[model samples]
Target: MTTDASQSQAHTSAKHLYQRHQSVLPDWLAVYYADPIELTHGEGRHVWDAEGNKYLDFFGGILTTMTAHALPEVTKAVSEQAGRIIHSSTLYLNRPMVDLAERIAKLSGIPDARVFFTTSGTEANDTALLLATAYRRSNQILAMRNSYHGRSFSAVGITGNKGWSPTSLSPLQTLYVHGGVRTRGPYAELDDTAFIAACVADLEDLLGHVRSPAALIAEPIQGVGGFTAPPDGLYAAFREVLQERGILWIADEVQTGWGRTGDNFWGWQAHGQNGPPDILTFAKGIGNGMSIGGVVARAEIMNCLDSNSISTFGGTQITMAAGLANLTYLLEHDLQGNARRVGGLLIERLRAIAAQLPGVREVRGRGLMIGIELVKPGTDEADPDGAAAVLEAAREEGLLIGKGGGHNTSVLRLAPPLSLTVAEAEEGAAILERALRSTQF
Candidate 1:
């Protein structure tokens, strides 16, 4: 068939598929772009659309594709595990599960850490909530403003992002706290030291008013809230306050774990004056897209539950195998170091490009997890339309990026695979530069 004819056929097929998807899928399910491309497959840091158009995938399937797409180590482990057995209930001893849990516990930094696997970050966080509430004997919880934990009932209850949380009614009593987003909010004007102090004071006041709260849950870097983060030591300061009250500190490392931030293995370490959080929940990139989630906590808190509990699909042999392989590859290759070097170069390049663009508001974040917030030219107002235009334009330029933010979703989120190379970084930055240029009004 002629190229034109083939293009027409591809468009028709995509349209038909989209219509079918809309007919069946929930209306609230958000898809990227005006014309969403169906990704057929991916390798390394790139993916191809159904129409055979290839793009550098910067979002990495929302950062779930950690080390790389179709990583050979992970794929081989998954295949090998499937050959033996895909799953065995928690009723039986699972070697892979035990192995992964051992590694995570030592790495967790929590005293006498114990790990419990779950199927998704939402489930992992839900489990953390259960543990904290049961241990503390209170349903009142503290969360950061503009934070997003997950979509489940318990997770959403603690989520402070209005854009993602659908309902106000929740099983847990959640109090939204300050210091999540550093660029905006009442504390934004303060210096880092003052900001930390202000947030700590807010927590202290909130704690005094409320009955014994279960725990304080926070994302080291607010992922869905546009890669925003508080001052480095904010959490450590809060840890001091919470320790006094005996409230647990839960680090939601769903997006910030596995050395993505470069300087720290865990995001909480950026604020590491305090020992470690009482609990830590992680998912997205652990299995490198193989579906693994978990929470790590001190044995005392984790063992608080009286009833027997098991996530039917959590810690299945196949997923555990994948996690083991993925973690090994990441460590062996020192992909965290790569993320540091390449991501630093990429962020500097983006900042230089942003300096020349009037609509570019700010360039922020550490390592591979970066956010470029766009705004109205010569003003502080967020420009969500400009962000949308840039996302669409980036796709046209054969570069796939992501959009997010608490303020109207105007921040361009970039989290490529940890294994992204220097050449890929330059290429993706050039494409992004052109995309940002296209958004200039």
Candidate 2:
């Protein structure tokens, strides 16, 4: 068949699929692009659409593909484990699960750590909340403003981003705190040290007004909040106050964990003044795309529950095998170092490009997790339309990126695989430059 004819057929197939998807799927479920393309296969840092068009994947399936697409190590582990057994549940003795748990417990940094595996980050965060509330015996919780934990009902209760939080009803009384975003808040104009002080003071004041909170949950680097974060030591400062009042600190590392931040193996390490967080929840990227989520806490906090709880599919043999292999590959290759080196270059390139564009509000992030916030050319108003235009333009330029923010969704997110090469970074940056310029009206 001719290439043109084949492409037309593929496009038609995708259109039909879209129609079916619209008919059956929830209306609130969102998809990118005006005409969405069905991704067929992926390798390294690129994916091919059903229409056979290849593109550099900058978002890495919402930053879940930590290593790379179709990694041989993860693929082999999943295949071999599948041949033996897929799942035996948490009831039976699972060697792979125990092995991965031991490794994560040691690497987690919490003293006498205990790990509880879950199926997704939402579940992991939910587990953390349960532990914290049970341990402290308080339903009140503290969470950062513009932070996103997960999509589950319990997780949504703690989420500060109104866009992601569909319902106001929640099991926990979550108090949203300030100081997550450094660029656009009351503390935006302050220096790093002063900003930390102000946020700490705010926390102290908030605590005075509320009941004793169980825990303070935060994303060291707010992922869905446009990759925004407070000053490095801000959380550490809050820890001092929370510790005084016996409040636990839970770091949501679903998007920022496993060395994605480059400089630190875990995002919480960036604010490691008072040792590790009391509870740490991780998912995304640990299994290198496998469904793996877990919460790591000290033995005392983790053992607070009296009733028995077991995840039937949380630490399944296949997922554990995949997690073990993926973690080994990540460490052996020093992909953290790779992220530091390559992501540095990519951010610099994007920043340089942003310098010439008036609509580009700010480019902020660390390591591979970067965000380009868009705004009106001459004003500070968020340009959600401009962001959408740039996203479509980049897709046309053979690049796949992501969009995120608090409520406006005006920030362009770029988080390529940690194994991304310098050449690929440069190529993606070039495409982004053109895409950004295309929307400069």
My TM-score estimates for the predictions, one after another, are 0.98, 0.99
Tell me the whole-model lDDT of each prediction, alpha carbons only.
0.92, 0.94
List clashing residue pairs in candidate 1.
none
Give per-residue CA lDDT, model 1, range 1-441, as digits (tens): 238778788888999999999999999988999998999999999998888888999999999999998998999999999999998889899999999999999988987999999999999999999999999999999999989999999998889889999999899999989999997888888999999899889988887787989899999999999999998999999999989889999999999999999988899999879889999999999999978899999999999999988778999999999999999999999998998999999999999998899898889999999999999998999999999999999999999999999999999999999999999999999999988887773
Candidate 1 lDDT score at position 343? 92
Cα RMSD for predicted model 1: 1.2
Cα-lDDT of candidate 1? 0.92
Residue-wise C-alpha lDDT for candidate 2, range 1-441, written one tens digit per residue:
239999999999999999999999999888999999999889999999999999999998899988999999999999999999999899999999999999999998999999999999999999999999999999999999999999999999899999999999999998989999998978888999888888989999999998899999999999998999888888899999999999999999999999999999999999998999999999999988899999999999999999999999999999999999999999999999999999999999999999999989899999999999999999889989899999999999999999999849999999999999999999999999999887773
- What is the lDDT, from 0 to 100, of the residue 355 in candidate 1? 89
